[model samples]
Target chain A: MRTWTWLHKWSSLVCTLFMLLLCLTGLPLIFHHEIGELLGTEAHAPEMAADAPRVSLDRVMEVARARHPGKGGMFASQERDDDRVWYVTLSDTPTSETDLKQVAVDARSGEILTEPQLDNGFMYIMFSLHVNLFAGLPGMLFLGFMGLLLLVSLVSGAVLYAPFMRKLEFGSVRRERSPRVKWLDLHNLLGIVTLVWFFVVGFTGVLNTGADLLVQHWQNNQLAQMVAPYRGQPPLTRLGSLEAAVSAARAARPDMAVSFVAFPGTSFSSPHHYGIFMHGDSALTSRLLVPVLVDATTAQVTDTRELPWYFSALLISRPLHFGDYGGRPMQIIWALLDVLTIIVLVSGLYLWLRKHRAGAAKEAA
Target chain B: MSARRPLPHHGGRAHRHGRAHRHRPLWRWPVRLGVVTLVGLLSALLADGFWDVVSWLALGALVAVCVFFGWLRRG
Candidate 1:
């Protein structure tokens, strides 16, 4: 019991502040699309006929490239809910991770809709603080460590609950008692209530923190092997038609829809292939991406393979952490749970502070 | 009389032991709620429509429990 108490106190104290920040930032992120729509930053393609002739992928790429004269294409993707618009991302080089631009093009008319701002917005700030604290990969890993501590704190706290609640019934607050006792009961009640939720979210968030590392590993392993035949070939001066490449990928996986296209030389693709990712229509399989490597010059499907177990796990962890799987009701429930978690964190901190002050005063006396 | 004397003492001990045994399962409610929460978290991710509704109700139950104890049921 004493060891569990010590573990709980130290671990909660170490990570409580970061967990609070995450809870606060994560609340708004649950409604990112809704908020984007309200802010008028979300682009919507004008309504077209159901059988309207859609513009070619090549035209969309051309329009996106025209917006940025010298930048190279990194990725072209559509929003999960809105397939009518293709968001083309460009950077200094194909593999550069910074100073990127996004241009939204209408899928049917090939018209420029908007250049959605990637930085300096309310949601952007929330996302940066929630994910990395604006310090990039190091910040991400630091938070992941904090998440680990949070798990330790949760386990220890659960252990301590057995002792604390031995006398009282479950959900008994004893509000007539002292403030400390009331808050302590509240802490236990709310903490245990949110325990499983907090654990799932924290565990998945920690996994998501290693996203860059996982992608790099995938690139060096499966991706490298897939493009082994064209390993030493010089980069193509003129890439093949984007339309033909996507068509080849679709023909290869007739049951799946194209999720995104990672251009040649990007981190997601090899130097000589277009990594066209395909996804299923179901809720679960949609998160699992199947990569189809197409030769950039010939527009021929070179290789196709399902992602490894670790990669699939990482992909599945995303929706569990984000709470975006269900619709508005789920988002609302997620926000409410987040608020409850905040209360738990604050009450826990208060209990620790009060105990410390009481201990100090007794010693002085 | 001597044999009967232990009877009362033994009954008292048994009664006390029964209460303690009930309290011993401290994990009862927490584990049950944890299972419900686990089901809720996974159901929505697996499918839509009916499963999503199940998820909402399961998770919403926890929030309802908190509100009932923390605010509605006051001393």
Candidate 2:
């Protein structure tokens, strides 16, 4: 018990300030899309017939290539909520990450609607801060480590809660007691109530930090094996029909919809095959995606497989952290939980500093 | 502000009313439920259409937690 107390105290002290920053930044991020739309930077697809015959995927690729001139299509993804639009991303090279651009294409007409203005504005600033503290991977990893400390603190705090509340009730907030006691009760009640939320978000948040590492692993392992047969083959100058490739992938995974497609030589695809990522329509299955490999030169379906468990976990963690999956209501719930977390952090800090001050005064006496 | 102060008597902290309710369930089970709720809510994000039940359940649980805290605060 003493060890648990020490753990809780030090762990909370170490990461309270950082967690406060995350909770603050994450609040606005929960509504970033709505905020973006209000800011007039939202890219909307032109309304079309609900059952209209859409243009071919190959035509969409052609339009994207024409718009970018020398660049190549890295990825194309349909909007999850709106089927009318498809986002096509292009870069200087298919594999390049820097200066990458995206175009929202009218799925029916194959015309560029608007270039989504992202990675700027106040939301972007908040996103960067919440994500990496403007320090990129190292910053993300540091926060992930802090998240670990937060988990330790939560566990330790829970351990202490039993003893502290042994003689008291579960949710007791002693308003008549010292201010610190009142805050402590409030903190414990809120913390325990939101324990599941804070832990899940923090855990998944840490998993998301491994996103770059996961992509790197997929590139070296699974992608390497899938494209091994074409090792000596030169990159195809004239790509086969994306429409045919997509059809072949659809044939492979009939129940699932094509969520995104990574063209040859892109980060998500190999040099010889197009990565057709298919996903289920259900809320749970939607997060799990399976990639189908199609021969770029022949547009022939090669192989399809469910991603390894860890990678699938990473896929699930993304939306879990963002709280955008269940619509506005879920985000609202997430925001409320975030507020509770803020109270926990602040009260924990206050308790520690107050304890230190009391100890110092006693020493002087 | 003393750590040595006695526990509160009113509100959510007053669990010592009856002798019958004093049974101590293992802390491991509550800890386990916390873990399940955590995973359930997170996995809720992946759901859509008919699978929205999980998401809804997760939301309901969170809402309940908030309401409980509100009641505690009010008391």
Q: Estimated TM-score per prediction?
A: 0.94, 0.87
The reply for model 1, stretches above 4 Å from the true place, is: B1-25
lDDT of 2 by residue, A3-119 (tens): 888899899889889899999999998997788689866667666669999999888878877887888888989866676788898888886857787888888988888777545
Clashing pairs in 1: none
lDDT of 2 by residue, B1-75 (tens): 123323445545363542214434424434554765665575556445544556666655755765565354564
What candidate 2 gets wrong by more than 4 Å, as runs, is B1-75
> Local distance difference test, per candidate?
0.90, 0.79
lDDT of 1 by residue, A1-365 (tens): 67788899999999999999999999889999899999988888887887788799999999998999998789999766667899999888987867899999999999998888898899999999999999999999999999999999999988778778877898999888899999999999999988999999999999999998998899899988898898788878988888999999999999888789999988778888899998888889888899999989899999999999999999999998989998888899999999999999999999999999999999999
Task: Please name the candidate that would achieve the greatest DockQ relative to the true structure.
Answer: 1
Model 2 chain B lDDT-worst window of ten:
B18-27
Output the number of the lDDT-best candidate: 1
